[model samples]
Target: MMMAVGVAERTGLLETAVKATIARAPARLLPYVVAFVACQGHVMSDIAILVIPPLAALAFKAAGRNPVAGLVGAFACVCAGYSAGFTVGALDALYAGITEKVAAALPMGQEAPTHLLVNYFFTASASVVLALIGGFLTARVLEPRLPEPTGDGSSGDEESPTTEISKEQRRGLLLSAAAVGVYTAVVLVVWLLPGSPLRGEGGALIPSPVLSGIVPLLFGAFVIAGVVYGVAARTVTHKNDVPKMMGESITSMSGYIVLILVIAQFIAVFNWSNVGTLLAVKCAALLESAGLTGFLALVLFVLVVTLLNMLISSGSALWSLMAPVFVPTFMLIGMSPALTLAAFRIADSATQMITPLNPYLFLSLALMRRYEPGAQLGTLMSRLAIYVVPFLVAWLAVLGIFYAFDLPLGPGAGIEMP
Candidate 1:
């Protein structure tokens, strides 16, 4: 996925898509459009953080608004709405694997959900709602409070004169889209045919080979689209370019690879010592005694995670440490591991702007400094604080609605244990 996304980015396919959306948006709707685009950035992973802000600033400047506000608002949406997206991402797969492992250790009667789409229904809906909230805040609250961009909006750095999509880029995007569309059609045909090999026993689609093999499917789709785009855009002049790009992508993930190794050891020890089960049993008993076993228990968990997220900015590290304990504790109370994971995502994402530990917050500040040289860290945090209350409140309300109706979190995954 990284290799493909990198190739698409290098070929300008991603930037063209973003620019096309912004270029067509009306002045009054720019905030919402930018916000939606930022939320969609999760599909491209961290690249969106670096790509969206400056482009958004340019869009705001074109629309006669404060470019700095545009940059800040887009950055906030990308970070705070990180977990919410229409399409499942690598993070979803990562957390699902962890949830499956922790739940498996607990002897939960029902099967634990390891599917990437386990939280799809909730997070996908949240993506749209959060985008709307981001848009409103950017237009009504954020822009008015932020100072106007000074000194010709250049930020003392080399700025692109325009965001116009080049002819080569447009052609590459067209070819990429076509390639992905064809690839998807072929996959669907193969999977949906009568007596398809992708199906499980009795032709069950949920636990089928197609669903379980989604990672490879996604990888193939992205690689196909990216390579097509790169070739058309003249970015991949030789066949070896694709392999080179893949190697570079893997190289960039060295730090995360090391972190995962440590996390694996920690989880192994956590399971072997039986401390996780003991802590879970005691915590479950306490929650049950306090009459906080359901909605209220989940609410408290969200709050705790929100607070912890401010202190520990790495989502993967935090989830790795917490999942062993919380997954089982919630399961003991008859809640599904998926639900526990969903609550964690809400708290983890919503407080990102206020977390000083978030390395990306510093990246955002540097980007803002390009437009506002006098912008202080305190000022940025204060302005960002405006987003915390509304985002948290609105997101919790979303969870409440989902809980009240007992909606399925994803395919064959519910709000409670079977």
Candidate 2:
């Protein structure tokens, strides 16, 4: 995933795509379009936090709208939609792996499946809904409150130049898209054909090779698309360039890799001590005694996570600590790990923009100042705080609808333990 994103970033495929989308949008629908694209920025990871806001500001400026509104809206969407996306990516894998590990600590009668798409159905649906909410807020609520950009260049002494997609970039995007299509088609054929090896016993698609093997599949697709884009865009003239890009990507993740190691050790010790299981049983009993063993308990859990997120901006770090206790405790109370995970995701993301602890918040504020010049962090926070309630409300609504209908969170993963 890192390698693919690196290649895409290197070839400017991702930037070109964002620019192209904004270029074709109608003036009135610009916010809506920007909001939706921002939600999809998970593909670019942290770079999205840096890339989307400025581009959005520029696009809004071109459309004679408030550029600050565009900047804030994109930043809000990227943060709030962190754990929600139509596509399975690194976040899904990280959360799923941790959930699976902690879930295994408990001696449940049945195994809990925590594959890459464990929350796929819920998140994909939430992505669309959040996009709409983001767009509505940006267009009707945020833009109207902000002043128009004067291009006074209080910060730069000159107006920012307009962004454009070059002919080569257009060609690269087209070829990369075609590459993704061809790769997907081939995979579908291999997985869907009769007597396919990807299927499980009795030909079940769930618990099958295709689902379990998603990481490699995603890696292949991304690499193919990115490399194709790189070649077509003239970013890669030699095969060695691909490996160099991969090396650079891995190097960039050194800090994250170290963090993961520390987290892994903590989890291992927590489980080995047998204290996690004991705490979970005791906690579950306490919740049951309080008659809070169902939806109410999950609600409280979400609230707690939301508060903690303000202090600890790293979702992985927070989840690593919480999952050991909450996941098994929820499982004891008849909730599936996936259901508990879904709740954490909601709380984890819904309040993202309001938190000062987030590194991205500072980055976004810096970007905002590029246009607003005198804009302060507090100003950015206030604009972003306006987005929290609507995002939180809409997210809770979706969760309620899914839980009430007893819908599958993902393939073979329901709202309750079997």
Candidate 3:
């Protein structure tokens, strides 16, 4: 995750490409641009919130629209869409890793193999759903409620350059695409070809190299694409530039690293205490005794997670703590680990926009204040709650429907365990 963001920042590939894409878009397509920026949150949620909001604000300003609507809409989408992404990335790998470790503690014959793509299908669907919801809310709700800008839509800068894509950037983007295409082709051949080494024993896809090794593949692909783009665009002049950019990227993520370490220690202590397991067993037994199994149990679980998200902002940390208890319990109650994870993701994402504890909330507020000097955190929260509330209801409804249908959460992953 750090490496990917570092490469993009160092090469200026993301910013340049995004600006270029926005520049070519018609005014009517500005809402789509906001949704697109929100979807990028799937890459790295915190980073996306920081990077995309300002750009979205600029895009709204350039279109002579309400900058507040653009900024808040982008922020809301990033928060709500954090759990859904088009491609598998670090978050998917991290969740799978935690699930694997925790599942090992389940009673011997009950444990299931934890694949990285366990929630891929559901999340992919969620990405599209949330994007459309975000676009609608931005245009219909947020924009209408926002007061018109008193000044020219610029954020204190009257002389911002026009959004344009240069020939060099175009060539660079094409070269990057070509690099990704070649790499993807190689991966497909290795995994899909008969008797290929990437496939598991008996040529199975599950528990195969492709499923287990997605994170490293993502890192390599992003680095390769960034390097190719950088060279073609003249962003990288010498051999030393690559490492320099990587180092800078790591430096920028120091705060996140510290947070991870603290959370890691907390998880370790929680596990050693055995309290999470005890709680899970008791809760599962209670729910079962109370006839709260199946869809009702799942709904209750989602609501619990949603409330927890208000106080705890870190998804990985919260999952590390909760999965130990919830995964096994849910399995015992007839739900699959993948379904449990899907529910967690929906709940976590739905509440992020309204959570005051989220680090991005502070950053977003700061950004908002720059545009509207009188912007207060409370006021912003209330406004964003409009989007968050409906998203929560709609998302829970989606989850309930998914549960009622007994749909597959991913390839070979059903809602219930046999």
Candidate 4:
């Protein structure tokens, strides 16, 4: 239905509409082996978020000469979407342990906003670095050498510049720039600018200057930018069309929304059950008896978190279960909870994109198949590894060095937050 509508909208063809509707074809059409392999339940992250990636990828796919740009663009969108941090999605779980530990009783869960900078500054920066490197590798290395048409939507031999495509690029870039600029400025004020609105009342304000604002800022930015870009890109033309595009975006997101809602509820329920707090307490107590140095302890904590990620896909759940223990425990060791959490986060995040259990990975693979049908999990992983590997190492190194120096992750954000 979606592919069909998109094809009709693009080609203005009615007869081909029925055939065009199915892109990769539904799971029912997959070969028995593929279906069996895909059923492993590894992909558990909230998938509704995929809407953002495709929206961002739409222009790139239309304008780029190769699959590399399109893939990078999609990842960019995913990172930005992750920046939102609401929806009790994968990210929320990751930071919940730290966030709630730092600032108790988070009124903001999935529906409300959280400060993205305080909790997610490191993640955001890592995301940008990864995106740039991925884009470069795609454009310079893969685009020029990629093989002929093979994927579901692969049109290697039939490339052409369309006015619509040009228009979308112009619109998307403009909207993306404006949105990112606004978001950056907000972070600057809260973290860099003195007397920023969110600056805590005084010293006791637990990482006073930098409050939780980045995620909401990002969410607002992307939602607005997506709408504006849709109109400016002519993907949507009329004022009325704006609503329709949003409607279309939301309509396409029913499945993901449902999943995230459950995820959110599960998070709240898990917290209410006090399971997370108990687990954190027990772990922290056990670790305390070890007498490791602050840095060594943090390093081990991060490794543990990374391994935990393989078993549990929910970042929020994991965090909720970890922060109470790690943060206070680290604080006792003369380390900041924020820093401790940040270190763990760096380790936890770099593996998500590569994990087989991540549902979004499958979506990415599906999209990749559109450009190269024969592209399998291993092939995509190999291609992604080149950039992702560098990113992981660079990011972890920067984070470790940053925490060791007791640098602020952002304004009012600091090495220590009781």
lDDT of each: 0.83, 0.85, 0.77, 0.48
- Summarize candidate 1's per-residue lDDT along 343-395 as a digit string, tens digits: 99889888988788888788788778777888889978988888888888777
Highest lDDT: give the candidate number. 2
RMSD of each: 1.8, 1.9, 2.7, 10.7
> Per model, how many backbone clashes are there?
0, 0, 0, 25
Indicate the TM-score of model 3. Answer: 0.90
lDDT computed for candidate 1: 0.83
Model 3: runs farther than 4 Å from truth?
Answer: 107-111, 153-163, 255-274
Q: Write the per-residue lDDT of candidate 3 for residues 126-163, one digit (tens) a residue.
A: 77777778888888988888876554434454454345
Candidate 4 lDDT tens digits, 45-148: 33323432332233334433453344533453242223322122234433543454333422222222224345455554554454454445555655456565
The TM-score obtained by model 2 is 0.96
Better of 1 and 3 by TM-score: 1
Off-target runs (Cα >4 Å) in candidate 1 are 155-162
How do the residues 1-418 of candidate 2 rate in per-residue lDDT, one tens digit apiece? 6776777777677888888997778989998888888887877878888778888888887888888888899999988888888766677878998898899888782487788888889988888899899999999988888865545323465455445877887899999999999999999888888789988778877778987888888889888877898888888889899889888988998988998898889889888998888999999999999999878898899999999999898899999989999999999999999999999999999887888888888877776776677788898999999899889888888888889899999988888887
Q: Once superposed on the true structure, which residue ranges of model 2 sit more than 4 Å away at CA?
A: 152-162
Q: Is candidate 1 or candidate 4 better by TM-score?
A: 1
Query: TM-score of every model?
Result: 0.95, 0.96, 0.90, 0.58
**How well does model 4 score by local distance difference test?**
0.48
Error of 4 at 54 (Å): 8.3
